[model samples]
Target: MEYITLNNGLKMPIVGTGTNTYGKENNDYNGEVKNEIPELVSALELGYRSIDAAISYRNEELVGRVLAESTVPREELFITTKIPANEEYISSKEATRAAIDNSLKNFRTDYLDLLLIHHPIEDKEQLKNTWEVFEEYYEAGKLKAIGVSNFGKNQLDDLKKFAKVKPAVNQIQINLKEPNKELLAILEEEGITPVAWGPMKTEAHQQEALDEIGKSYKKYGAQVLLKYQIQRGVVVIPKSHNRENQAANIDLFDFELSAEDVEKVENL
Candidate 1:
């Protein structure tokens, strides 16, 4: 329900739907989770305007189908997808173009709100070349904005050095328990919006504190956790199949967390 203006001068939802499924660690890319369709539909019904997906997630086709059938007009939705760093795909201009084309076809959209280099290439030269192409796509209007995911400060520096267009966002796994403050500071200094992928599953988050904080705002622990990230100026995409949870993630604009409460959550 909140928004962040990216370095590229575009507004991105501060909270959205993340579509990575279970068993993603086991190489089960795109296992066809039938629930995502209804989950996304329900998210839209509940006022979620953003959908974060990636090529490696393997559910683009189905998600696209849901997007096509949803009652909300396409312009109202913010869609983002990524290109994996695998050699086969980014080996050449032709392959990269093909991969992006496939995403457009799958999403059933003419353009994407954002696109990212899904992961950093181990090879810096290759990474540089890949980013150049992404910039080309941005210039051509194939992608509205481009960014990187799971990149460390060093890699970000390299990309920034050669970049014609600065990255709009950087998505990584960050939570209240272990906030990765060093990287967060770097991103803040660089003017790139930080996006938290797994904002809820934090090992250090204080449940008692979260529950208590939620009481003052009539929110739950998960909502409090998400609110912490939003208040600190990070974007979040917390996915859920449960309608109640989906609604809670977007129902975050009503109240603001006090600086004292936010600091308490951070210290926890």
Candidate 2:
């Protein structure tokens, strides 16, 4: 798999798997945790090293157990999990510290590859406190990198005012349905990597166009969509339960999209 170098000089896989529904009943995001995630096992077997998880998913312990139990060594895996913005996690500096500590315990790791605030903290005091705690962990060598998810320019600017270390990445929705062009440009200007969630969500017409483009390269529309994002220096975490689809998600290094085809995708 290809990698994106973050602002902090750390390398992250350009393609990863999202685990919002892993270990949940009926594969539902809000479903109860049932203790096993065969899909995660399948993903690891299929060569997916980047695992995106969050506290809000309510299955961190289970996900962490699977990772700890897997044959893949910790050094070879890129594990990313988020701390929720709720009071339970971000109410105080100590609270945030405890939350992160618990997450480390759940994952059975000495250090996490990356940790992010699940959402923008509207209260400036809370935001400052949370970020400072993140900085503390990062300095202590527990969290390799710290960042924010679903943050707009205003939030990022707010954080920048008191932040000594800049955010390494901004995870946001970047599918064709919500391209987020302006924010993407801002991230580019600021030297921050953009990680796209819901990358496969596209209109039928757009999918058809990608399919036509993929024919020349002998790839699927989903592969073309992911390649488009990575080609432009954006990281994509597209998850799939189907083994074939999982294999296809990471099978993106074989070909390159021409300038003309890229423009066509851009216009779409």
Candidate 3:
């Protein structure tokens, strides 16, 4: 597996298994509520070293289960979770610390590989305060790296102006349809790697484009999308329940997309 070095010098896997299947209307069983423990365990066994979960996802405990049971060592895996976006949660430093503690407990890990602010919302001051707490934990060696999610350029600028530790990553929606070049450039300029969530836009709106690209590549639409992001130097976390697809997703290093091919697919 390929890795990206964060600003804090933490190496994160370029591809990961994202555990965001909460309240997903399409899935028969919700990951958080129904417990997709088996799939998570399978992902680990399949050589996935990074698992992205969140306090809002409510599946951290299940991920913890797989971590504890898997043969993989704790040091070999990269576990990431986010603080909830609730106003009350962000308003208090104590609340933020408690939230991190809860996540550590849920994941059954002594330290987090990464922790991101879930979203840019409500009180800005409170959010900055929350970041300070994260920095404290980082200094104490509890958090290896800290970052933000769904933050635009303005929000990123705001954080940078007062932030003690620059964000190591900006996790955002980046797919063929929503390339988001502006935000990505800003992140790159700031030495922040952009982690692509929803690299495969599973929604109906993007299905046609994904299919077209997939046809050209003679691969699954999801795989095409994931490859696109990785070639762009963005970390991608594409989730799937099917064991075959999960394994196939990581089998990207064997091939390279040509410049023209990249442009053709990205233009769509």
Candidate 4:
């Protein structure tokens, strides 16, 4: 697997497993809800070193279970979780500390490889305060890296102005249908890495353009889309229950999409 170094000199895998089943439109974790632990185990068995979960997902404990049971060393794996966006949760610094403490208990780990604010909300000051607490955790060696999710350029810029530590990543939705070039350009300019959620566009929409491009390389449509995002330097977490799909998602290191092929998908 390929990796990217954060601003603070931490290395993270380019592709990972995202455990976000609650707010997603159609895809449910199903009975696999209980299987999240095993699913993470499966992902690790399949060579996935990064596992993304959130407090809202309600499966961090299960993920923790798997991590504790697995033989994989904690240092070899990248475990990430986010602060929930609920008003009560983000309203106070105490709540933020409790949330992190809960996440640590849930994940059964001493430190988080990365942590993020789940989304932008009405309380900028509270958010900054929460980030300050995260910085404290980083200094205390409880969290290795910190970032935000679903934030646009202005929000990130605003945070940067007063933030003691620049965000190492900005997790956002990026797929063929929602290219988000403007935001991506801003992230690139600021030297913040982009972590793409729904790299295949949630489950409802399929881009035929991706299918057409996939035919050229004999790759699956989703694989083509993921490759496009990776070429643009965005880290992707394409969730799938099927082992084949998971394996295929990480098999992208073998081939490079041509400039012409990239343009075909880009223009589409």
Candidate 5:
């Protein structure tokens, strides 16, 4: 797998697995948490070392159990989890610290590879308190990295006001449907990596074009789409239940998209 160097000199995998719906009944995001997540096991078996999880997903213990029990050593896995912006989590510095400690326990790890604020905290004091807590953990060596998700430019600017450590990445939706061109440029300018969630969303026409482009490389449209994102320095966490699709998602290092084809995808 490819890697991107963060501003803090840490390396993150360019591709990872999104586990928002894993370990849930009927694979539903809001379903009850089950004891096992066969998909996560399959993903690890297929050479996926990066696992993206969140507290709001409500399956942290299961996902953490699978990771802790996997043959892959703890040092090799890149585990990322988010703390929600709700009052229960960010109401006070102590509250945020408790949430982080709980997440670490749920993951069965001493340190997280990355932690993020699930959403922007509207209250300035709450935002400052939450971020300061994150900074505390980061300094204490409990969190390897800290960042934010679904934040617009204004929120990011607000964060910059008193942030001691700049965000390493901004997790956002980036696909042909919602390219987020302007924000992406801003992230690029700021030296912050952009992690794309829901990366496979695209129109039928776009998929047809990607298929045509992939024909020569013997790849699928999904592969081409992911390649487009990573080729442009964006990290993509594309989730799939099918084992074959899981393997295909990580099988992205063999071929390179030509500049002309890349431009075509950009225009799409």
Candidate 6:
């Protein structure tokens, strides 16, 4: 798998499987969904070494259980989980520590590869405090990297203004439909890698172009779209329940889209 060295000196896979689907339909606490475990097993067997999860997803314990049971060693996998942005428990340092500890216990591990703020809270001061707590966790070795999610350009700038330790990555909706060039430029300037949550998201009207371009490489439209994001230096964690699709999504590094083809998708 291809890797990008984050500003914090940690290596992240360019393509990984996102576990959002596991908790989307299930609300039962302390239980694992039927397909979730098998899907994760299949993805791991298919060579996906990175797994993205969130406490908001409600399946961290299940994902952790599966990983604990898997034959893959802990060092071979990179796990990421986010603290729920709207939770009341994040306002104070003690509460934030408790929240992180709960996620750590859920994962059945002592440390996480990355931790992110699930979304931007309204109050700037509150957001800054939340980030400071993340910094605390990072310094304590509970988190390898810390970042923000769904933050606007202005919000990111504001966070960087007061942050003693800057964000390492920014997770956001960065698909072919909305690349957010200005925000991407800011992330680049700050040395933060852009992590795309739904890189394959595309409108029906834009299908033909993706298909037309993908056909030349014997790749499908979805592959073409994800490839486009990777070409732009963005990390992608695509959600898929099917094993074949999971396996196919990570097969991106094998091909390189030409500059003309890359521009074609950019203008679409």
Q: Which candidate achieves the best lDDT against the true structure? A: 5
Task: Write out the backbone clash pairs for model 2.
Answer: none
Candidate 4 displacement at residue 206 in angstroms? 6.6
Clashes of each: 0, 0, 0, 0, 0, 0
Which is the better candidate, 3 or 5, if ranked by TM-score?
A: 5
lDDT of 1 by residue, 92-111 (tens): 87788888899999999889
Ranking of all predicted structures according to TM-score, beginning with the best and ending with the worst: 5, 2, 1, 6, 4, 3
lDDT of 2 by residue, 130-164 (tens): 99999999999999999999999999999999998
Question: Model 3: per-residue lDDT, tens digit, 1-268?
Answer: 9998888888999999887763334443453266545667768878999999998876678678768778899999999899878865776899899899988998888899999999985577887799899999999999999999999988887897788999999999987668899898888889999999888775675666666767756776667767878888899998887789889888777667778767866667
Full-model lDDT, candidate 6: 0.85
Each prediction's whole-model lDDT (CA): 0.84, 0.93, 0.83, 0.83, 0.95, 0.85
lDDT (Cα, tens digit) per residue for candidate 4, span 5-28: 998899999999887662233446
The better-scoring model by TM-score among 1 and 3 is 1
**For residues 109-204, could you state the per-residue lDDT of candidate 5 as single tens digits?**
999999999999999999999999999999999999999999999999999999999999999999999999999999999989999999999999
Off by over 4 Å in 3: 22-32, 202-218
TM-score, cand. 4? 0.91
How well does model 4 score by local distance difference test?
A: 0.83
Question: What TM-score would each prediction reach against the true structure?
Answer: 0.93, 0.99, 0.91, 0.91, 0.99, 0.93
The whole-model C-alpha lDDT of candidate 1 against the native structure comes to: 0.84
Error of 5 at 238 (Å): 0.4
